[model samples]
Target chain A: MTRPRVTFWRLFIVASLALGAYSIFVRFHEGIGGATNLSDGTPWGLWVGLDILTGVALAAGGFMITAVVYVFGLERYRPIVRPALLTAFLGYLFFVIGLLVELGRPWNIWHAIIYWNPNSALFEVAWCVMLYTIVLALEVSNLIFERFGWVRLSRVFHAVVLFLVIAGVMLSTLHQSSLGTLFVIAPGKMHALWYSPALPLIFYVSCMCAGLAMVMVEAFLSQRFLKHPVRVDLMARLARVLMIGLMLLTLLRFSDLWLRSALPLAFQPTEEALAFWVEVALFQVIPIVVLWPERRRASPRRLFVGAFSAVAGLVTHRMNVATTSFVSSSPTDYFPTWMEFSVSIALVVAGVVVFWGFAKWTPLFAEGEHPPHAAHRAEHVTRARPGPPTAISGCGRARRGARRLPAPRRWPGGRSTAPGTRC
Target chain B: MSKGMLIDITACTGCRACVNACRTKNRLDAPPGARLSETDFTVLEHRDRLAVRRMCYHCNDPACASACPVAAMVRTPEGPVAYDEHRCMGCRYCMVACPHGVPAFEWHSRMPRVRKCAFCPDHVAEGRPPPCATACPTEATLFGDRDALIKAATARIDARPERYYPGIWGRDVAGGTSVMFLSPVPFDRLGLRTDLGPDPLGHATGRILALVPGTAATVVTVLGGTYWLYRRRAAVAAEQALAAARDGADAAAREGREGGR
Candidate 1:
């Protein structure tokens, strides 16, 4: 059988390459010193805060997808694995580029790799990212190989896939949260409300939440582009994630406050404390409202809103942690430069392009397999009958990826295997 | 023994001459971005009316040195927190973990790194005043031996009990800093974060978290290797499944033909 068409891969490549090139020019011309707002008092800026730290957290969907589908045997994510892994792949690509642009002595970056001291926190992030990107590329490349009639090679490769999946998960688990640990040393520099010994733990947990939110965006966009309805079950799963993220974030906030027990002043006529509380309320409290059992069943739109809100909350959290929290004493307070912002914009465009190519080419939206279930339900009241749906099975790359379920072939539901039912 | 400086905020007038002098001496560009990256070696942070000139508060057990997985930030026996750019991966964990947020990332450069005060050890080695100290017209930012500086700080605090804070900023903070602060108000009030506990973050987390990098390395290589292997296995199973499927199809086709005959 012929493969599906990928209309936009070329366009995506061109756009991503162009954006990267532009950012490279900006990075070189300004020099990290002159272009960024980082000061002697505050050396770190938004590129570190948002792009490197939060960006990695948001891209966690790939690990989460693979983990659920492979390790936990959650078959539902099979359809999402390829796309997730691909996104994870590109996310790391952008991350590497961003770092290169940020580095002052970009030429000497290899020195750190070769002459590792094994005592720096950054060395850990560097090596982990370096290794993890390779893992991601390798994982995603299998699909390309599978599609290209290299089935035998892919077979040889499958022997260690599980081990790789497990390792990828472990590395992601460590590095994702370590982004937060970056701030743990700043107990004195960070505002009291934002600083805590539990920062590493908090960071880890927040990324998990961010991962879900990221997938929610993925699911939402996939639905929008594919013109397929987002699954109610998927929304249910997302709501569950939001509930856990927001609840734990709330718990952590309160616990940190309780430990210090001087948090009251943070909420009173003070700008800093107010920023803290507002972030909590916006990012956490409101999202939990619609995640209740009663609400989860009633609406998908509500779920979408909840996910978006949580994502917003997560972004704000990153900004606060990276910027607002350390506003005092640190002379450097960061705002994104034009090139930095442009590059970030380019990243979003790249994600769209990737999503577009995946949707157009892959079996991700195939009819018998990837039928629009939500659409059927939405128009169920008016349609006399709905067409046959595909059966998707398999445990890893598919959600029940290759599971062969008998499609209903009956009229008014009478007997017969519907024609062209194989998926 | 390595010498140090103790800043008695009681003496500082926020003159900022030291900030200019260090920048001039180091040839650091005027801060174009945020205030921190603009200057090097010496910088100023203002809280309310008090000014704190911050450089490197090199510690006896510096958190940056310990937090570095690559040992980029090394602590000298004499107590200077020196950075080796060649060994830095630009992860900025030191910037995040520093109690004073002293470690700064050169965020704009392609080969950026963590930059912070190195105690002007070169000049100090020559038995000359550190640039900032020599530049301080008001003598607000001072330099001396570690023991002598603390003794002088204590003497000042003792002689003018009402004028200075009851406690020293760095003597007990993070196991003692090469640079100490003297303030009229409490260190906490001036936004000179003193909340970091007596134990350096390195001692508190190094043993357990240091494994993070090595563990990460092991996990990445192992996982990368494993994933490659897993894909191969799945492909073999798939081929086997396909063969079984074809044989089943052929058998069914034969039966239908035989029945028709």
Candidate 2:
């Protein structure tokens, strides 16, 4: 039987790209006023808040993977690093493009470099994002260089990989937390429900949870989509990271709620209050319940759902803080236009397509941690022709039972009797 | 002399004319108050009954500048928050990290960026004033040296303690505000969150951060260099191991072929 082929994502991307391009041209001619719904009352709407700030945090899965692999020497995560980096790279790339279009004087966007502006938080965010993107690009480029047989270039990049990795890690850390700092200034405007001194720190830590959740979801989907079996060891490790981040996130929230005298407000039973309770319930409480256990984390289905819930919770929390919970008596109420949603869709779909194409074409999957199921995952059709197998059976799929390095070949040291293979 | 802009929200009428003037003077899109883009610097926001003219105050020690791993948001000596989108990675962390909720992120479309008010330093440097200050119909906002703004803010507070209520903002809030404010109503009533203390928001975490560029540069260089060396060693070992494995595989394949022959 032929495997199910999906064209929806690619087709959707083409449509959105067309719209985005058209809208961009329209911006040039008529200007952004005609294109966006931003107003003096509601200065930033969906594009500025949702697609960029929130999106960047979601894409943070890349650096966390790298840190695990290179910094902590978690050899098991090495395989997932390339894919995670690719996702991070594309997420930032889309963000970069989206930001460029938003620039009023696109040409003068470089003035921040020639003339320093140490007085602005935006300035730091800009520089960090720029430098970090270059770092991520270099990290991803190493994979390409190795794949193309450019041994020397690959060596140079590999030598510098640690630098790029560390840089990426540091950059992600600063900006991730800084996102909360943006809203900290508006204590009056933000609902007492969400505002706190530790907001920036909380936002940063929350990203850790969101990113790990996305990684879990990505792992499951990739396993199914790419026809690779999930590696148990890597999944277990990833689950542990998610568990730790969530635990910390929970502690931070509780401590902050206590310090601010805001704990009682959560009990008022208002809509915002209820939403808060529900969000925490999903993002922190429920996930903790399912994830605190090692056995549950090891299960693929449980891990996926738990991670999805955590990511959803974080995303909602961001939206709440940025817009929903904070009812700045400000005259603006922002809603992303269909065009905005289209653009967001385009970025996500593009990242997916890129990941799939790059994986098929390049050696991106040669990561340090090929999941515990490396043998099973790697036991796909030959690279030349990726097709369904002749007979789908337990033996065919389970042929990779002893894929570990220490494990002897399946069926013991049984060398092929017919082929004069060295025993 | 560290100079800063003084913003008196009581004088603002929500006209957004200052936004228009800033855009035209800044060579921006001149979009109406509704169509805010990254170019629409000095946008206006109506919080409750308040008309907050949003712009980047040329802070004395800005979190944005210090957080910058690269020198993108450099505060001019005179005190203007200038930006370079090209140098910016569009991370939008500044939007997230800013204490005043001033910086805006560009989150839509194919290409996005940040949009914030850079004080009209070009005109100010030429001995004029910021466009927002000049364009205000009610003179709710003023452009002057930091000292004068502080003095004026203090006098207003001293003269009418009951009228001003609480205290003058930026006088001691979050280190200090480059743009000072004098409100007729309570600041909280005006939808401005004035609860932040004078402590540097960055330092509020109770951790002292090295914010200078030279220090950050050194840290980046040292960290990067250290990681590079470690990775080089690891890559070398991994390569040697891979080479050995490949050689063994090739020899085994050759033996198998010869045996078949």
Candidate 3:
């Protein structure tokens, strides 16, 4: 049953990748005008709105999960941390590719490194994204080190894991808020309903909601495809956290509008007003309502619905901010071309394919306590008491089943010394 | 002394001499269309009886310069904002940040650069007025020191209250622009934005970015302190667990010896 589905996905990914490559070649050969719908009036289209902004915002899960486990010392949440990190790393890697396609002079992208513009909000965002991507790479490297049995190197990373987590959180906060700051300079061009003096604060709050909901979405997907177990208690707690974030975001949005006296704009019978209401409903109202009851929060299906809604809502909000709000001011109309949409969809597919490869090849969902170094064995041993059924327990069963089944011939080693055993 | 321009809309005729002069001076290939583009640095738009010439305001604190991530857009001390194409990465952020929406991009080029009014920096440096200002049939466009031009604009407004708008259009808008305008009617009716306010737009973004260092310091201290507290607590718990287990073993051994006796 699974074989046919797996082959279908593989074929789909390959076709998408080929189309993306052709579109990219056309972009470079014919220039941005021939390839994209973007014009001088609308210099940014789907590449900036969906691929860069939405993609980066969704990847906030990496910092959120790491802070929960490493900084807050919640050891029970350890099993999901590696998966979240892998997702984030792939998300950022694809963001760079999207940016390359969007940039008019792709080769000069490194000019931001040598040149300085401390006053520019974009300058801050560029620096932070570069730094944070590196930070995430280092954090995810522990899995690689363990898979190859580089115990000493992994120990070095383990020793300073706390510092790395703290830095990642700080970098994430800066860039995430600075994205909103980019639009703050153009109050006259942006619609009053979307424009506010507190935009940076609003962006930061909304990202927290998106980040938490994204983790839940990933958890549900992995459980279905990878045969990983879903921890009902842990997911319930995450749902509670997501509910609080959604509430905070709602409060921030309404209060900002109210304070600016732009609340009346939301009631107007206009396209902008409709978009705003839809965004609020998808991101704020629906998630909060679905996750309100304890029984619904515990049910995996309900939790997935709420998470998917929040993620969809985040995409809507970002698109509205990036494109729709400028409709009244822009001289020309912008709708992304088929080539643009293909490239964006292709980047997303590429991310999924890379994540799947990482999951299959590495010990991404290893069972038991996985301390990177033996130095941390004492801490793990002390906290080794059995708790609720988790992904860890599910992974142990999966490992045993894998031993009986035929292992893939492509692997360098046999089943006994596979990637998961060392870790 | 900063250079500036004062455009008196009341004096302009519907002739297009300035537009022709600007095109000729820049060596542009074709005649300008209805709007600004890479080929047209300035354009004259007809609004009822008045003819308004639109170009870069050359703001005192330009949002474009502040918005450029690589310092590609720069504000010259001579009062005009300049573009350094070699430094630009073509992010198009300046186009987004501009209040008047002046910057134009070359979408058809493989390596596009942002294009806008240069304010004739070369002409200004050589002590000659811009070609458009010199080519004006009437004294519609005047170029001189920014302060003298502001005084001239105020004098014109004060003398002809009935003929012109009540105030100088660019005197305080967006924290004061080097190029001021005298319009027969309200500026907004002429497609100029009046709601940009008196503060520089860059100040808003600057204020947010200024808080970064403090935010980073606070995060580090809090997270570091919390991790230390948790590790210490775990160590103490582990020591207690080990001591309790040892005690249980000693009791079992003693009870076994007593039973044997």
Candidate 4:
């Protein structure tokens, strides 16, 4: 393998990490008042809004992709599953880290685990987030175990993998919606343009779209970096799914406004109205326009544009709902301090760096029948040649069993090599 | 049986004695700036010469108590909503959930806690008026049974209809706060919200959340069934493949025997 070189992006991430470390120190040493623009009026600033909320919202793709592959039995989407799982696991890890930093007493955060508060929406969110992260860790560990040739452990993980996926989907559904439930209490504080009894439902649906979009965007980035071929057709199909979700969200939100006599509020010339329009136009409208056409869907770049647009829109929607909408009602205005921004940016960079590192080490994109690395590939080839007993008879038996198993239909993409065949 | 306070805003002199009394009683330092803080729970707001004391309303159905994940903020039987600093993890959900925005967080503290008026639990437990009420020489804030305070407020309103706004704040706002208000001008003009409905803010979400058990059961059943079906199909396919391979091997052996004969 070629030695990894010092790239601009890598240098940028290192510098950001250094700055982020200092900002985090300031946060701990000086407290929130010194490090953040949060106040009595605006208690939840960019940390809660951008870091935690948006972080979880973007991580929705993990459950979505896992459900698509495992539950729905879509064999074609298997290639993207590990990457999605890795992204989600990292996304949630950083979310927890952000929660620790944003929280006033980070040590006391575990109280939610020991103490039961069935009444609080945040309690539900806290529980679900904790449980789902555990599930993701188990799911993603399949790749890690496979990397180290831990066959017995990998077999054990597979034995309960489906159940874990179902539980993840259920927990994800609960908390993704409950994040909206956090805002349900602040009806007076939240703008009518965003607030509704159906916020949970809206949030649930939009997150599904956000998750799918994230998977699409991540798939493109991963394919580019990992030297894997782009599955444009599969991504186009995913875009269609995102479009359906976006349409449902747009319909639900506007009709909800109409029923509540708040539709006129959207048309009014105000910042909230403009923000609402921007969210709709950028995320909901533009993606629908770009991905709706068959010709547009055929282009890989177009698919990415649609996905990125939806991702950006979903992020903006969460930020607007969480922070921007409350500004008018708040006693003091809020803009994130430089330290707050640095910490948030650093968290994202950290996630990407971790993902990059994992992809380099693990067989995240390899088919289940095959292990990664040229050495592993050579070993599999020798085992497949029916001449003599392989030195490792156990590996040989495993290879024979894998070959006997029914291979899924060869997907139409470049480098379509059978498992155990040298690529 | 819960105690409450009826603050007649028209009678207040804007002297801020209640604010001073609360700080002195709680032994909390007065942070600079007149805004509410961890130290200063009560603030006297003057709007066009009419003064009103702004603090935690100590609602009969307090949103903060319901929003608190650990029950750190709980309503007392004696009527004041109090905070247990020991139990507090300080997630500050109460701050977000408060319609009145009464709960203030200790942003500067290393070991932070949520801060708000507890309606003087020591005074309520001892059958004495809260410090603020005790300090009000004008009887602007009268402490008694909630029903009695409501009756007195109605009688006062009926006696001189022109002196009041004709609506008592917190009578039904957020399902009746322990601290009710009377004003000459509108409640909104005094930095109080009038738009909050009678229902508890936490009730709707709680009702939806109550269905989670049923939702979980249904999800498990559906997914479990799907898993079973997928496993069954894989098993059936493997069996069929084994049967076909056996038939081919037997036919190849028979052909070889015939050729040898």
Choose the strongest candidate by DockQ: 3
Ranking by DockQ: 3, 4, 1, 2
Candidate 4 docking band: medium
Give candidate 4's error at residue B78 in angstroms.
Answer: 1.1
Clashes of each: 80, 48, 0, 0
Query: 1 or 4, which is superior by lDDT?
Result: 4
Task: State the lDDT of candidate 2 residue by residue for B48-70, as single tens digits.
Answer: 67776666655665656555434
lDDT of 2 by residue, A118-230 (tens): 44445556667878888888888876765665644654565566667777887887777656655554445567779886877788798888887887777777888776566
* TM-score for each candidate, following the candidate numbering: 0.73, 0.66, 0.91, 0.89
Clashes of 2: 48
Give the best candidate by lDDT.
3
TM-score of 1: 0.73
Which has the higher lDDT value, candidate number 2 or candidate number 4?
A: 4
Q: Candidate 3, TM-score vs. the true structure?
A: 0.91
lDDT of 3 by residue, A377-412 (tens): 433342343442322556664444333323221112
Worst 10 residues of 3 chain A by lDDT: A407-416
What is the per-residue lDDT of model 4 for residues A1-423, given as tens digits with 9 covering 90 to 100?
Answer: 234544767788888999888989988887878788888888888888878988999999999888877876666677788888999999999999998998888888888877777988888888999999999999998777777766556656765777889999999988999888888878878888888888888889988899889999988987766666778988988988888899888899889999999989888888888989989888888899888977788899889999999999988898788877887788898888899999999999999889988888987777532322343445445445664332234466455534543342212111222233221
Stretch of 10 with least lDDT, candidate 4 chain A: A408-417
Local lDDT at B204 for model 4: 70
Model 3, residue A227: distance off in Å is: 3.0
CA lDDT, candidate 2, residue A4: 31
Candidate 2 chain B: 10-residue stretch with minimal lDDT: B204-213
1 or 2, which is superior by DockQ?
1
